[model samples]
Target: MTAIAVGLVCLLVLGLGLVVHVFGRVFEGDTRPTLTNDIVVGTWRGADDCTFTFNADGTFVARNVPVSLFNPPGTTAPADVARGEWELTAAIEDPGGRLATVQLGFETVGEQGQVGIHFSTRLRSNTVDGEPVLYWFNGDPDLNRRFILEKD
Candidate 1:
């Protein structure tokens, strides 16, 4: 009887341990990659054929990018090439962790002459087929009209 009681207690403890492990995984939040300098220092392309090249020296150049992306909503204009400075800062607090905010400031030389523009968005990260991917949303997320730029 003593041996049986000990075995039962052992089983109970193992079962509790298994339950905790499963619950921990269930609440582990998302698998989004953490924003870092090394992860963001690269080229990213958008669906609109806009390419953003980020250099290690905290500078960036964007080509074939729509002017509306940097302007207010409903401002339709042609694409423009620009060069500027970029920075990342901690922003959103997620269940997984805090995400970074990306800020871009550039000057576009068009028929209207050189115009300075500044844009800010949250830096989002994800994985595709075991590869880390980074992106930023260009429009209102709730409306589902999002312009996404994916890392190259």
Candidate 2:
């Protein structure tokens, strides 16, 4: 009975250690980018030719984005201009608050007065090839569905 109890405790400890290691690695290499209001409040272009303009008033405009980029087939994918709201959740203007990421919500208004939030994404800042980029996973397991953007 004593040996069995000790073995169970060892297994439990090993499992907990593994969990801690995985959790620590989650944000390990993130190297959160330095974010500032001036640097972020501008127009950004995605690889798919979509443009996102972040205004100073916490408003945003999304243009030239295709619905098919996100929605699967057999769905109502309307390619249209979207209006949305955005904000810097981490650092208002401080570069030290580099850990900050942006959250945006977009809405689509139909012709018959139907308004709905059709898309939402969280963008994290990173540097690629000596240039800044914003990226997010589009909820696809294929990895290629990841959306990336660069300053326009």
Model 1 CA RMSD to the hidden true structure, in angstroms: 5.7
Candidate 2 regions off by >4 Å? 1-28, 68-78, 90-98, 109-119, 141-145
- Model 1 worst lDDT window (10 residues): 91-100
Cα lDDT over the full model 1:
0.67
Question: Each candidate: how many clashes?
Answer: 0, 0
Using TM-score, give the best candidate's number. 1
Model 1: residues with Cα > 4 Å off, grouped in runs: 1-29, 71-74, 95-99, 109-113, 143-145
Candidate 1 lDDT over 17-136, as tens digits, reads 999999999667456655677878899887668788889898877777665465667657745667777776655655444544566766554434376555543445666666655555
Q: Report the Cα lDDT for candidate 2.
A: 0.70
- Could you list the CA RMSD of all candidates, in the order they appear? 5.7, 6.9
Best by lDDT: 2
lDDT of 1 at 64: 76
